[model samples]
Target: MRRSPFTTLGGSGFDGSQDAEARLRWFEHVMRRDMDAPVRRLSRMVSGEVEDVIACDVVNPDHIDVEFDSIGGLESIKQALYELVILPMRRPELFSHGKLLGPQKGVLLYGPPGTGKTMLAKAIAKESGAVFINVRISNLMSKWFGDAQKLVAAVFSLAHKLQPAIIFIDEVDSFLGQRKTSDHEALTNMKTEFMALWDGFTTDQNARVMVLAATNRPSELDEAILRRLPQAFEIGFPDRKERAEILKVILSGEKVEDNIDYDRIASLCDGYTGSDLFELCKKAAYFPIRDLLNDEKSGKPSKEPRPLSESDLEKVIATSKKTQVAANEYNSLRSQLVGLSRQTETDDYPVQAAISELSKLVVSQILNLQAENQDS
Candidate 1:
């Protein structure tokens, strides 16, 4: 006869009370041997579920094709990120002295649209060799109630598992904006949960996780969110020199004439953003192709199109207008704000009202410019 596996538990055969007792003993023995099996299985199930939900958002540093060198201008911003984010993450031992010296839990990158804020975040991910979780608002939302909160929790849990991770939220103002009473319950709960997890990470001195957010309208963010992001950098428009450098970088890979005056092109691009410069270059590049097509259509034997010339860039510049907030107008408004503050101290000229009026005017002008750009 075949022997039963439970025979080791003092079982002789399937007979009577002794056999029942032996079975009981065998059950207890098995439980003792694998007591933690269920717990381990539960933990793995939860982890696998979280991974399934957010696996698409996780990005390895090696896959991020951006580098700090590829980004033009913003040298100061790059240096700041290198020191504050990359260095600490790369050499945590150097920053393990105290809570104050530990890596920042949250960093905000605020600027106008197309100022390379997102690009900078990617460069940081690439340079720091940290896992980048590109958190989108859609990823957290769920049709089922209470799931949003769980998803939010999952984000932090995943980030914790993948230590030395950067959770990058582009246009974060839309995600964690100033909370209103009319806000959806799910959204409010998700935001609360997100902030709570963000604060929780700070208690662990060794955790290299960081929340990196970018927005054009920082003022729209909730006060609590801003408080968590103590380290904020303003990525404003590039200056004339920076614009020239940007043009050079954009055209570096293009077939362009050596005599193309980048300085003049930059000057013409006055209030243009980095994105605007790239579009300008893109439009100019087509000129050569257009000429080649014309030559072919006319039955003229053309070996190849001529290299992009200064006149080609000039033509594009003449037609293209700056789509960003006018630098001069922005500077003027800033000066007025400063002057208003000074006047508040010296002369009581209804400073608050004047400041409010100036703020409104700035907003209206920006809106009008946006509308004009969209229309064009």
Candidate 2:
């Protein structure tokens, strides 16, 4: 009796009896043009004949050299991540010794654009001393059905192999949107598979892989995904003091005139985020260089590079606008979240607290309605 081609390769294209070294040789021969084909093939085999969708890149611990102290402001956010992620990874023996003080399974950083969400993840990865896996939504999407699901499984398996790893999913809202009945079959399957893999990370005590995600629109995330990420922190706009601190930090290494006023510049950047502040500094730095270049072109270059002055910053500030969106829309969404939190009985306190801080007015309204309903 003749065996099918699929049966000969142990459900893969290669035969199981072949040695690992021999399999590698054959893979290398056929995949000269495409480097990822062999890896994908191997992933399919490791995933038990599941489709291959592994597009994410794994970053070694040495590459992530950013420390928590380097990130200015948001000290509270840094402290929480240290306790939740870095502490657990560094001292797993403390977590696994029958104590309920296990590390958090997943953490979410959410807020408006340019609030340093990705920066926080990098800092955590550096602090944790664990392998970092950076995954984007584009890496998860696939034209093939069931491919994304298998890829999700493969990613978790890779994380497990490299135990004590951090998987940072940037722009998580796009990949794990609110599940709907009318969703595409492939999308639904991918979501289900991703969540299942996430659950596995939580249950496996020895598997020290933490999922850290950042999103500008946390409200767009699915309820199921929110439950998975029990620890959530909002990276909102920096207060006036924080803005001044941020400006000082940004200008620390730059050549600035003695008369430049940080407090005044901070006041000018009313609604600016950490990123916006950085941009403002860059714009100010270029002004002097730009003037020098123009002078040189006209055969009137100065003796030396002039230091950035308050006039230059003021010019930039006059032309530059803050990127803050209208707050009323987010205020209403925040109220809805607080109301949902009240009904939730699970141990998702961090998520609830972050949502509650969005707006106190919404919280009061919801509480009054609940009280009136009970009285009636």
Candidate 1 segments exceeding 4 Å error: 1-46, 325-376
Error of 2 at 366 (Å): 40
Residues 33-54 of candidate 2 have per-residue lDDT tens digits of: 3334223333334433322223
State the TM-score for model 1. Answer: 0.74
Taking all chains together, each candidate's TM-score versus the true structure is 0.74, 0.71
Worst 10 residues of 2 by lDDT: 2-11
Cα miss at 38, model 1 (Å)? 28
Q: Residue 139 of model 1: what lDDT?
A: 72
TM-score of 2: 0.71
Candidate 1 global Cα RMSD: 15.9
Report lDDT (Cα) of residue 159, candidate 2.
72
Q: Candidate 2, 201: how far from true, in Å?
A: 2.2
Model 2 Cα RMSD, 1 decimal: 14.4
